[model samples]
Target: MHRTLLLLVVGVSLAFGVDWFLGEFIEEYVVRIINLCGIAIILAVSLNVINGLCGQFSLGHAGFMAIGAYVSAYFTTTLRVLNTETGETVVRAPLFDGAWGFVPALLIGGMAAAAAGLVVGVPTLRLKGDYLAIATLGFGEIVIIMLTNFESVGAARGLPGLPNYASSFWILTFAWICVVSSVFLQRSTFGRALVAIRENELAAEVMGIRVARLKVMAFIYGAFFAGLAGGLLGHLLRTISPSTFGFMKSIEVVVMLVLGGLGSLTGAIVGAIVLTVLPEALRDVEQQAKLPGIRMVVYALVLILLMIFRPQGIFGQRELSLKLLRRLLPGGRK
Candidate 1:
């Protein structure tokens, strides 16, 4: 079903998009929304490692992504993404054809984000409980404020001219990378260690698990994907504003976790996709005027109801596997 749905989506997108591109109507805007969904998946699932599996509440996701985006954008631009004081436009590279030039920029941007995960993780991972959350939140704020204050990088004005490279293809590809990497980690011994820590750091510590070290590793990896997502976001809009990676942005990522049920990577992906599509569907169909933020309000209400009723989430920790089928379908489960 997953494969079928994905193929159908791609086929429709290509058919409609090609027709639009060649027609007088210009292009289908839905492609951008699909790309946005792909990035959201990365942000939601990657954060699930520490926030969900490890039972750590983190809201600093946008900060890490911003770090990656700024660094990557800084280097990719002709100006080298250097912090600007005089307010400069981030010059875009001329596209070679239609896609390749912009595509490579995103890859380089993702690598830059991975590097930031390691750098920022080293120091901040030491704190625990509220202290850790505060520290991460502070880091995010610091990133946003720094970008806002740095006049050379355009300060609050934001930088523009980035190559819009985040197409449906790239978004889907990287989203898959995030999905596979996170799922593999969860099933591995190291992943289980994260679970151990999540359950009780004191117990994990007594058992000789390097709790602090694992937390840092998870944070860094999470930051890496967040950054990659930011890169995709920047390219999608062709602009980089300091406010783009704000605390509220981080909260949205958390919402995906909450809606999908904490600790389930698959849940996070589902939540992200559902939310992404909901907005588009709502905008297209809704006739009555509503608050611009109504979507989030609805999301919040749904989350509240989920926590009250099915607190374990859509599947909880029980992953989707063929093993479950054996008991229900006799030979079919196998």
Candidate 2:
């Protein structure tokens, strides 16, 4: 416990210190990229819980993210004013501003996403393999269509003017929290049960594991963090559109998980960072060479090469740790 607390303190200090001191020195675009990396880390890790650990194929992650983004933005921007004389609630400016409203709004957003996960998971999780994948894909498309038609959230016009409260420090803090929680969960008995089901559902059930309940739990847990990531992203950009959380967005997260090595937390983090930065790096190169769409061509080539050379992904279900680091270091034990 003491060690954990110490690590937490150190992590918090480092995050804040970087945000306060190093942020000023960095270019705004670089800072934005870093923040996006953090959000991607959260999304990838959370999806790892369901897809990696539980062996579930879900493509509706973006839908949950959309729910969180729109809900949180609504809470932060819309205010209800009560009038005693008319006994009516009037719409006014947002009730919460800055940091004061950001935290609660995020929580509400997470809860809302979790609820949506429950609603979807209860019935859909019973399906296995490609059927599950198709179901989730349908769900994601449905969500995007619903949002596009929902005028309250500005519909296709999108929601704008969200408070810019998602600082680098906050993004890092929440991402770290997600990392710790996911690691802890993976180490617990519940995590073991999920793994068992992932390996063989019938055998797991015979061994007394409640596959349905556990799967639902995994869905809810994963959805919650995805929502949190969405809220952070919405606030960071200060604007959001339904189109932003479309099928391609879900594919992006899946690519990170696959590229990182499914079921490996460290891989998820590394993959998120690498993939998030790769496009930007390529974009720079493209501009210099005056080549349009070159970044995507290179990105596709990299994925193909990776699949051919390292089919199991960069880490292949293994995690990086102090011991592994030491083994890789010079003059250290092999």
Candidate 3:
């Protein structure tokens, strides 16, 4: 316990130090990229719980993200007050200026997304493989379409003028929390059961594991964090539209998981960082070469090369830790 507390302290200190240093020294564009990386990290890690750890193919991550973003934005942008004497209601601007209000708004968004996950997971988890993927894809489309038609959350126009409340420090803190929670869960009994189900569902069932229940739990868990990421993204961008969390957004998150390594937490983080930076890094090259879609072409080439060379992904279910780092270092632990 003491060691754990000490590690936590050190981790927080390092996080804060990095956050401050980057804000102080880095250019605005570079800092924005870093903040986006943090958000991507949260999304990738959260999706890993379902697609990587649970061996489920879900494509509706963006739908949940949309739910979170809209719900959180609503709380932060729209405020309602009731008069005690006149029994009249007044609507005011959103109030998420402080951490106390911001935290609850984010949590409510996450909870709402988790509830949606529960509703979706209970009925659809029975499907497997491509069928499951199609189902989830449909769900994502349905969400976007609904939001597009719904006028309450700013139909096709999108909600704007939101308060920019998501700082690099807050984003990193939440991302770290997601990472630690995912890592610990992967080391727990529930995680083992998930792995077993991934390997062989029938055998897992024969072993007395509640397959359906576990699947639902995994979905809920992943959706909760995805929602959290969405909330962070909404506040960071200070504007959100239904189109922002579309099929392509879900594909982006999946690419991070695949590029990293399924079932590997460290791989997800690394993949998120690399992929998030890749386009920005290529911007100069693209402009200089006068090439449209050059960035994507290069990105595709890299993915193709990776597939040819390391099909199991960069990590292949392995994690990066102090012990592993030591073993890889020259003249270090073997």
Candidate 4:
């Protein structure tokens, strides 16, 4: 425990230190990309808990994230004033002023999303594989449709004028927490049960595992962090609408999980970073070559090649470690 606390403290320090450096030396665009990577890590890692570790097929991540983003944005918006360019402003007393308010807002957002997860998970989790996927996909679509028509939260226009509170420090802190928690979960008895269920649900039930309850718990857990990531994303973007949380958003996250290697946390992190950065790199090429759709073509080709060469994934249910690195190096393996 002492060692864990020490490592956490060090990590926090590092995050703050990096934030300071970025603020001082980096371009705003680069910093935004960095922050996006952090958010992607959170999303990918949280989804990995459900799809990878728990062996559940869920397509409702976008909906869960929307819940978190909207809920937290509501609170944060209530706390701040929106100044118009014409010098007309609506002022209201702060709910919980400054950065401290973001904590409660995000927590409430995550809890709301977890509750939604429970509602969806209880019945939907009974079905397996494609059935569960279809059910969750419907739920996600319903969420987007409802949000689109909800005028109180901006409806089709979406919410705007959000404060920028999702800094590198906060984003990285939450991401680190999510990753550490998942690692612990994967090592626990409950995690073993999940693995068993993944192998064979009938056999897992026969072994006395509470399959239903565990599946719901995993769903809720994943939803909570998805909410947190959503909150961070909304704050960073400073605007959000139903379109932002569409089915495609969920598919993108699943793609990250697949590209990284299902069931591998390290791979999730890697996939998130690579996917988040790859587009920007391609954008430069698209601009230089004056190709309108070349970026998309290249992206598709890369994914197709990866699927052909490494069907499982780049990591293929494995992780990066000192031993793995040595094995990959020439003349280093026995």
Q: Against the hidden reference, what TM-scores do the models get?
A: 0.79, 0.93, 0.91, 0.93
Pick the lDDT winner.
Answer: 2
Residue 1 lDDT, candidate 3, scale 0-100: 67
lDDT of 2 by residue, 99-218 (tens): 968999998999999999998899996799899988988998999999998866778988888888999998998898899889889999999999999999999999999999999999
Q: Could you tell me which residue pairs clash in candidate 1? A: 74-80, 74-81, 84-152, 84-153, 85-151, 85-152, 325-333, 326-333
Screening candidate 3 with a backbone cut-off below 3 angstroms (N, C-alpha, C), the clashing residue pairs are none
- CA shift of 151, model 2, Å: 0.6
Q: Which ten residues in a row have the lowest lDDT in candidate 4?
A: 78-87
Q: Is candidate 3 or candidate 4 better by TM-score?
A: 4
What is the model-wide C-alpha lDDT for candidate 1?
Answer: 0.75
Stretches > 4 Å off in candidate 2? 1-8, 78-91
Residue 303 lDDT in candidate 1: 74
Tens-digit lDDT track of model 4 for 1-334: 8967986888788889999999999999999999999999999999988999888999889999999999998888753334546665565543655798998999999999999999999988678899999889999999999999886677888988788899998998888888888888888998888888888999999999999999999999999999999999999999999999999899889888889998899999999999999999999999999998898799888888988998788787898778999988999985
Q: Per-residue lDDT for 52 in model 2?
A: 96
On lDDT, who's better, 1 or 2?
2
For each candidate, what is the lDDT? 0.75, 0.91, 0.88, 0.89
Model 4 C-alpha lDDT versus the unseen true structure: 0.89
